[model samples]
Target: MRLKERTIAIVLGGGKGTRLYPLTMDRAKPAVPFAGKYRLVDIPISNCINSGIRQIYILTQFNSASLHNHISNTYIFDTFSNGFVEILAAEQTNQTDTWYQGTADAVRKNLKHFHDQNADYYIILSGDQLYRMDLKDMLDRHIACGAELTIATKPISREQATGLGIIGCDSEGIITKFYEKPANDLDISEYKVADSLLHASLGKHVDASNEYLASMGIYIFNAKTMEEVLNNDKTDFGKEIIPDVIKQRKVATYLFDGFWEDIGTIKAFYETNLDLASINPQFNFYNEMMPIYTHRRHLPATKVNFCNISSSLTSEGSIITNAYIVNSIIGVRTIIESGASLDGVYCMGASFYETEVEKTANAKKGIPNIGIGRGTIIRKAIIDQNARIGDGCRIGIDDIPRQEGDFAMYSIHDGIIVINKNAVIKNGTVM
Candidate 1:
């Protein structure tokens, strides 16, 4: 059978992305707006489609309304084609009555749907990571090695290995042992990879530190092996299943040297979004051969009058007048009035334009417009969708507000202010 037809992808949409708070308040983490317009889920979905793997399933739970909306609105396949991108939510059954306990349990509970399909292999991916990869290349390695399961690994520093699944490998690039977040003094030098293995898997060595091989949380399973593994009561792949399998099965590693970010925390998400606006971005989204695919908004082009924008991205249907924006990302339907200044911010913009009647009613209610107001100064902040920042407000201008906690209206993390979705900043407010 052809390789393309023998595989299907399963994207694990995480449960309650609490790490990305306020952003995940109204929508699932995967549905949270990313890179100004695209959702976090689009990264893996676009990779799968571009890699010629069309048949897919997205397993999601916890506030999936916006996620379901985005998926349904986008990704329409041919009428007669077998290709599909389906969303699978956890449900109660005669045997089980609870939600998914972990990533492996999520797949184990849904294995019934996949059981009927005759695919040879299953590709597992995370929905909230940023990377561009062709799964076909990893699949070829799995098939060639005759591996029952293959994990994609990347070289990481000693400090980074404390929170990830670190793999121990042999000279032939076969998995030998697995460690989940080992302590600093545990001595993981036994797993130090050979130069030949690094050169063969990735074109070059990515880390000069070369302390450990961190799993990218990407997995490819031989269909039969997954059936055998999931038959047991193991709850999570990283903490339980993978460690057990490496000791018994034919497992290999596929190294990826490219840019990959796990946008799991508010700090990570905020920093990663701003990474796109850099002169030489760590992760480039402008690859002509494989651009990131997203739901087309069909909104009109961005409009600007006497605005000064540099090193920023403004999405469609935005109206900017007499605003100075630098090193920021303005999302769809955003409106920036005159005398406003934004620097090093990520504005998700409004969900929808407020009608004239709605505006009049809002005025009566004393609510501000769904965008930046006149004479406001915003710096190093994240303005969530449909946020109302009133006139003459000062956000992160003089006070960094460096914090690791959340307030009722917003959060200040790593010296950057994050305005929650649908939140209101009163007129003349100073934050």
Candidate 2:
């Protein structure tokens, strides 16, 4: 059988993404909007599809309604392809009734469902990451090395290795030692990649600063090996299973020097989204050969009227009128009235447009409409979906320092103001 036929992909929908806070308040991390259009889950699924792996399963637990809806509406296969993208949510069973404690536990609970496929290899992926990787290359390397388990690793600077799992490998790419998030003062030169290996993978002119090989948390394992490893009581792969398995198994490393970002924290999520609007973003969503897939809302094209938008991305079904937006992202169904100014902002637009009657009713009640009102200036902020900003509002524009914490209607995290979803700001309000 071909690689696509014998390989099954398992995407682990992350636990309550507390670091991403308000964005994950009502939805799972994978369901959170990304790049003004796609969800975080789309990146992994799209990569799998592009690599010809169609038998996929996404294990979800917390706030999965939106995720289920998106998957149902978007990834449908024909009758004869034997391709399916299914969700295996945590549930009560004869074996266990608790929620998923960690990534390994999530997969172990769903192994019965996975076994129906009778696949040869299992590729495990994370849901809340942004990257475009061809897994076929990783799988080919796994087979060529005659390895039981393979991990995808990336070369990073020593400063970046403190928070990541560092791996030690020989020149032949066989993993020898693994360290989980070593302390800053600890001496971990033993975990550093050989300079010659770096030269082979990243070219001889590679930066001398990047000597550590950090695990990318992307793994490929033989089907029986996965079953054998999960037979233990380990709850997480990185913290428990990987470190133990390296000493006993033939674990190899696949060097990946592509652009990959772990969108686990609010700051990383915000910065990564804004970077997509750059002229030459590190992660390109416009690659025609490996297109990212998402829900097709059948919305009309975005309509802009005399708006000065530069270095920004505007999604479909948006209507902008005489707004000054720069270095920002305007999401779907967004409406900006005249004289509104936005800089370094990500406005996640409304889900539905308010009709004339509804707008008039809200006006009588002294409430702002569903979109940004006139003459509002916002900078370095994130406006969540269905937010209402009244006229003459100033958000994140002043030089005043705001405390970092969750407030009634919004949050200030990492010096960036995030207006909560469905929040309403009165006219002449200043932040």
Please name the candidate that would achieve the greatest lDDT relative to the true structure.
2
Any residue pairs clashing in model 2, and if so which?
Answer: none
Please, what are the lDDT tens digits per residue for candidate 2 over residues 1-431?
A: 77789999999998998999988888988889888888889999999999999999999898999899989999999988799999888899998889999999999999999889999999999998888999998999899999999999988998999999999999989999999999999999888788888777666476788889999999999999999999988999999999888999999999888899998988998999999999999998889999999888999999999989999999999999999999999999999999999999999897888999999999999999988999999999999999999999999977887999999999999998999999999999999
lDDT, each prediction: 0.89, 0.92
What TM-score goes with each of the models? 0.97, 0.98
Return the clash pairs for model 1, or none. Answer: none
Model 1, residue 10: displacement in angstroms? 0.9
Residue-level lDDT for 31 in candidate 2: 88
Please give the TM-score that candidate 2 achieves against the real structure.
0.98
Q: How accurate is candidate 2 locally (lDDT)?
A: 0.92
